[model samples]
Target: MPKLKLDIASKVLRLANPLRVAGYTFETWEVIVVTLDDGARRGRGEASGIYFLGDDAANMRAAIEDVRAAVEGGLDREALRSLLPPGGARNAIDCALWELEAARSGKPVWQLAGVPQPRPVVTTFTLSADTPIEMARGAVGYVDARAIKIKLTGDLALDLQRVHAIRAARPDVWLGVDGNQGFVRDQLDALIPALVEQRVSLLEQPLARGEEAALEGLASPIPIAGDESIVSLADVTAAPSQFQIVNIKLDKCGGLTEGLLMAAEARRLGLGVMVGTMIGTSLATAPGFVLAQLCDFVDLDGATFIVEDRLPSVAYRDGTVFAGPDVWGSGRP
Candidate 1:
C-alpha cells in the first residue's frame, strides 16, 4: 500500500436541547471526525461522547494523534484494525479507511463493507423519565411507532407504572426498557415480572457492567440484554450466565470492523445482537444502521435528538431507517 495522509478534527454536536435519560443529562454530544487522505481521495469517520466509557472529544482527538504518524506512514485499514484494539481509536481509523478505500476504488461503503443493502429498520424512541402523565403523553404521541424503548433507573414500581400507563395508552406499541445498570437484585426481580406482564420485549443492562455475575443461575422472565456489560469477546462469554442479548455500538466496540466480529460471536453463542449508537447526526447513525443488518433490534435513533442534523441525513420513514446517499468509504463525493 502507498503511504497515506491523515488529518483529524474534533467538533461538538449540540442537541437542539437537553435529553435526560435516567441518571445522565446532555445538552450536547462531543464527537471527533477523522478524515483520511490517501493522496488522491479523502474519507471521513466519527466518534461520539461516551461518558460512561470515559471517552470524550479530547481523548478521541488524542487517540487519533497517537496513531497519526503510523497511519500516515502507509498504514492501511487492515493494519489499523490489527494495530489498535476495538474502541474509539480504531473506530475513527477503520471508518476512515473504509471511506478512503471506497473513494479510491469508486464503490459504496456497503459494497466494500460487504453488508447487505440497507433495509427499513424500526428503532426505539426513548421515553425520558417524567411524570406518569407526561410520559404517557409522549408515548401517546409516538403511538404510531412500531416500538419504543423506555429509559428507567430508580423506583421500579413507579417506572413500571409509568410504562404501564404508556402501554395502556398505546395498546399496540411494542415496548423495551434500558435501566443503564441502575437495577439492583431486588429491583430486577420486581421489574422483570412487571416487564413480562407488560409484554416488554427487552431489558437492557439491568445491572452494572461488572456486576453481570449477579445474574448467574437467575432466570429472567424477559429476555435480558447486555449493553454496557459487553464490549468485547470476553463480554460475550457471559451469555449463558448473564444475558441472552448483546448491544453493539461502534463507539463502544470501535467501528464496523470489530462490530461485525462481535455480532458474529454473539450469534454463535445464540445471543441476539442489538445495534445501538450515541446521539448525533446522520453521519454517526449511518454506520450503525449498516451494522443493524445483523442485529435483531435496532436503537439508532441518535440523530432524532438533534435539533438540526446535517443535510443528507439518513432517510427515516415510519421508524425504519434508510441508508444515506453518501458512499461510506469510496471517497467523499
Candidate 2:
C-alpha cells in the first residue's frame, strides 16, 4: 500500500427553491468533498454537515486534516471509529475508504457490507414548511410520489392546515411529518389527533432532545421517529423506548460503516430504520443509498433539491432513486 494522498474542496449547491424547515431556511447547500489517492486508484466522498448541530464545511475539512497522518499511513475503517467522534468528518473519510476499497477490489459497497444487490428505492419527496396554500401546490407536483415528508414548525393551527391541504391535494401519497425538534409535549395532545386525521403514518422528532422521556409511555395514532434524539450508538440504545423509527443520516452517525451498525442495532431493538440525508448533491447521497436498502423508510431525496448534480449522478424518477453503476462505489460484484 502506497502513502494515501488526500484532497479537499468545498462547493456551494444552490437549491431550486428555498426550503424552510423548523428553525431555518436553506437556499444553498455548503458541502466539502474529499478525495483519497492510493498510488493507483482514487476514490471520492462528500459531506454537508448539520448546521444546527454546530457543524460546517470548514470544520469538517479541518477535522479531516487532523487525521491526515494516520490516513496516509493506511488507516482502516475499524480504526476510524475510535479516531473520530460521529460527524461529517468521519462520514467523508469513511465513505472515501469504502469507495477506495471498491475500486481496489472490484466489489460494490453493498456486497462488501454483506447487503443484497442494490435496487431502485421509493424515496420521500419533501415539502418545505410553507403556508397551507403553498404546501398544497407543492404536493401537486409530487402527486405521483409514493410517499411525502412534510416539514412542520410546531404551530398547531397552521401546521394542521398545511397537512390538511396537502392531504387533500395528494390523497394517494403516504404522508410523514418531521417536526425537526420544534414541538413540545403539550402540542402533541392536539397535533397527534390532527396528524392521524390527515392519515400521517410517521412522525419524526416531535419533541426536542432531552424531552424524549416525555414520550416514554405515550401512545399515538402514528409511530414516532427519532431524528435529533438519535446520533451515535448510545442514542440507539435509548431510541426503542421513545421512538418506533430511527432516522439514520450518514453524516449524523459517522458513515456507512456506523450507519449499517446503527440500522442493525435499531432492528435488534425492534425499531424501524429510516435512511435520511442532509441537503447535498448526488455524490453525498450515493453512499446513503446503500443503507436505504435495509431501511423501512428511504429519505435519500436530498439531491432532488439541488438545481444540478455531479456528473454521472444518481438517477431519480417517479420517486425512486437509481444509483447508476458508473458512479463511484455503486459497482456490483
Candidate 3:
C-alpha cells in the first residue's frame, strides 16, 4: 500500500475561562492537530497542554514541523518517533496514524485496535484548589455530581481538613483526591489515614515521579494511581510499590498509539487504568475519550473548565462523554 501524507497544524485556542491548578494557570488551551491525507480520506488527531513535559503550542508546532518533510514523503509511526522526542508532537502523529489507518480500513478506532465500543463512563468532576471555604463551596456546588476529584498541592493537613469539610458539607458525594505529586513518603502516614477516614476513593501521584522506589513495600488505605510517574510502557513495570493504577494521557505517552500500549502494559502488570487530559477545548478531550472507555476513572473534563468550546464540541451529558467515531476520526488500528 502506498503511504499517506501527513500535514500538521497547531494553534493556541484562548481559553474561555481561567483554568487553575496548583502550580499552573492556563488562560488559553494550546493544541496541535495532525491530519493524514490519502488524497481521498483524511484522519485527524488532537492534543492539549502538557506543561509537565515542557510542551506548549510553540514547541509542539515546531516538533511537528521538524518531521513534516519526512512525514509528507511517508514515514511510519516508529520512524517518526526517531525524528521527534516523545511528547505532544509524537502524540499527534501517533494518533493521526491510528485515525488514518482506521479511516482507510473502514473501522472505528476501537474496532481497529481491538478495543470494544466505549460504554457510558462516569467522569470525576474536579474541584480546583483554593481557599478552604471556597474549595468547600465548590464541592457543595457540585452537590449533585456523582463523583468529585479534588486537586491539592502538599499541605496535607490543610488539604485533608478541607476534604473533611467538603465531606461534612456533602456526605453522600463520592470523593477522590489528586495530590499531583505533592506528597512525600513520610507524609503518607498522616495523609493516607486522613484521606481514608474521609472515604476518599483514590489518591493520585502523591509523590513525585522517579521517586517510585521510595514507596516499596508500603501499603495505604486508598488506591494510589500513577499520573506523572508512568509516561511509557517501560515506566509501567519500573515501580510496583509506587502506584496501583496508571493515568494515561496522550500528551505524556507520545500519542494514542503508545498510550494504548501503555494502558495494555499497565493492565498486564496488574495496574488499574485512568484516562486523563490536559486543559483544553473539546478538540483535545475528544481523542482522549477513547481511553476513557478502558479506564476505571475518567478525568477528561479539562474543557469543562473553559468557558467556551470549539464548534461541534464533544457532548457532555450529566458527566458522560458522547462522541462518535467520525467526530475525531477513528484512528487506524
Q: Considering only N, C-alpha and C atoms within 3 Å, which residue pairs clash in candidate 1?
A: 87-254, 98-329, 99-329, 102-329, 102-330, 103-330, 103-331
Off by over 4 Å in 1: 330-333
Q: Over 4 Å off in model 2, which ranges? A: 331-333
TM-score of each: 0.94, 0.98, 0.91
Could you give candidate 2's per-residue lDDT for residues 76-118 as a string of tens digits? Answer: 9889999999999999999989999888888888899888688
Name the best candidate (by lDDT).
2
Q: For this target, which candidate reaches the highest TM-score against the unseen true structure?
A: 2
Name the candidate, 1 or 3, with the larger lDDT value.
1
Residue range 191-257, candidate 1, lDDT tens digits: 8888888889999888887888888888777888888888865577767678888898888878887
Which is better, 2 or 3, measured by TM-score? 2
Ranking by TM-score: 2, 1, 3
lDDT of each: 0.79, 0.89, 0.77
Query: Residue 189 deviation, candidate 2, in Å?
Result: 0.9
**Model 1 lDDT, full chain set:** 0.79
Each prediction's number of clashing residue pairs: 7, 0, 8
User: Which whole-number lDDT from 0 to 100 does residue 162 have in model 2?
Assistant: 95
